[model samples]
Target: MKALIRSSAAVSAFILALSSSGVLIAQAATTGTTTTPTPMTSTATSDLTAGPLTLTAVPSFDFGTATLTGTTGDKVPGSSVTGALKVTNPGQIGGWQVTVAGTPFTDTSGTALTGTILSLDGLATNPITADDSTNTSTLPTFVTPETISTSATVVESAAPSTSTSHIGIGSYTTSYDAAASSLAVPSSTVAGTYTSTLTWTMSNAPA
Candidate 1:
């Protein structure tokens, strides 16, 4: 009887061990799960630009005065001195204006000389004609023709040429168009080295 009891006790212990293992396996299965997220990369690009450029004349002019020889009182018919007006455009793209600083005037005499440029009041003693040449009607016919009666020439300019403008009446006016690279001087100018400072303003236009 004692031996039988011992065998039965061993069998019961084995069954209990199996039941514990089954419970552990069920718990593991219920909690078993995995999750993963996707990975990615992004990129972008852009382009920028600017507008056209602009250029203009500066405000400063540097046409030095002339040293007058003959007297303004001793007016002659055809006696006249010569002078030049220095014009220029400061910008990459050229521009236009009526004269070397907007108008022409004899820095020495300060006379209203550029009246006849046609664009002005048309009262200029001299007016510019064709071929950059000067003429009378545009130039004043002095009482003393020998003392003061002369004409001027419009010195042509290349891309950007150092040109001269003639003015006999006193102060003359001119116009400029940068695009055209052209300048205008009075038709009736004197024969001296007249000068007017021309300043330019730069442009932003494409080269």
Candidate 2:
């Protein structure tokens, strides 16, 4: 009877395997490939033109109104803006100078003022930077208490360039000091509005 039971159990296992569909299969996983980075480049530029050495700006002087003092010479101190003479250098030059002169002060009816003096007092020298910069070197000498001339007079001057440092290679400005400007009028001066033109001349002359 025990042999008969064991045979029945083996037949049942065989029938279960036969009733199934198909076999289960397992597939392996995989990875992908990669590459390194790359590099690139570009460019840029600018341009400059040569500028001429020249006097750029001239200042205007205004001496305030005064009463006629027919007894003696009259001195009037005046206040002014743009009281500096500005110059620019184009480089490749030795040095330079500035000369000053004035025309006769004339009234509306063409009457002229003779023996009138325009005194530009002590002017402070300025050192240049950038195109013309200041350094530990000898600077230009400026005429002080300058009694303006009918003819041209050297108001400011500089020595010739002995080397690169000596060359006048930048912009320059000589400014007026405090209460440094005045107009001197002779006795019996006309009591009317008068206008005068101050001629400022700049040159490449190295003195």
Candidate 3:
């Protein structure tokens, strides 16, 4: 009986040892550690471009103050003086002309100059007297008074055209080619401070 009891206790001890060893082996297990990798991505995206344009104008001629150097109201009857006029385009351009205009002139005494009509409608016509008859006789008269006595021609783009004695606007334009211009004071330019002025106007062409 004693030996049997001893053998039983030994058997019990061996079983307990086996169970504890199995528990330790299971608890000490090292799990394989892994982290899920994160994915990376990206997204991307295009137009027309152009250049700049520009114009400028400049007057080539300037007529300084014109004073009558001849005798008072004693201008040559049929002789003319020449002067220059300049026109320019600073930028690339095409098709343009200059037209001139102005107010009539008067004497230093503030008297409007007067003269007989030499022509009308491009023909000989009766004399058109001055508005202020006080100045009418101021104009020179001839024994054989022609239908037209005095005239003015504003030369530009070409030789000036003759105009009957009067106070009004006179204009001219440049020829086909863009060029400088000149004007011929009428041979019969009356004496006095003829306050005639020139103005330049621009245009594409005859409308």
Instruction: Give the top-scoring candidate (lDDT).
Output: 2
TM-score of each model, in listed order = 0.21, 0.66, 0.26
Q: Candidate 2 versus the native: TM-score? A: 0.66
lDDT at position 129, candidate 3: 26
How big is the RMSD of model 1? 19.3
Off by over 4 Å in 3: 1-83, 90-94, 116-192
Better of 2 and 3 by lDDT: 2
Clashes (backbone N, CA, C under 3 Å), per candidate, total 68, 4, 4
lDDT (Cα, tens digit) per residue for candidate 2, span 91-114: 434678888899999999999999
TM-score winner: 2
Q: What is the overall TM-score of model 3 with all chains considered together? A: 0.26
Q: Which rank order by lDDT, best down to worst?
A: 2, 3, 1
lDDT of each: 0.32, 0.71, 0.33
Model 1 Cα lDDT, one tens digit per residue, 1-207 = 999999999999999999999999999999999878788889897754423322222223222333334433221111221222223322212212222123343546664454322111111223222222442112211111011012322122212212242222122223222222212334454545433333332222111
lDDT of 3 by residue, 1-207 (tens): 999999999999999999999988887775546789999998763232221111122223322344444433332232222332333322212223334444344557665544422211110121122234433122111112212222323222112112433211122112111111122244355544444343445443311
Each prediction's RMSD over C-alphas, in Å, is 19.3, 10.9, 24.1
| Backbone collision tally, model 2 | 4
Candidate 2 global lDDT = 0.71
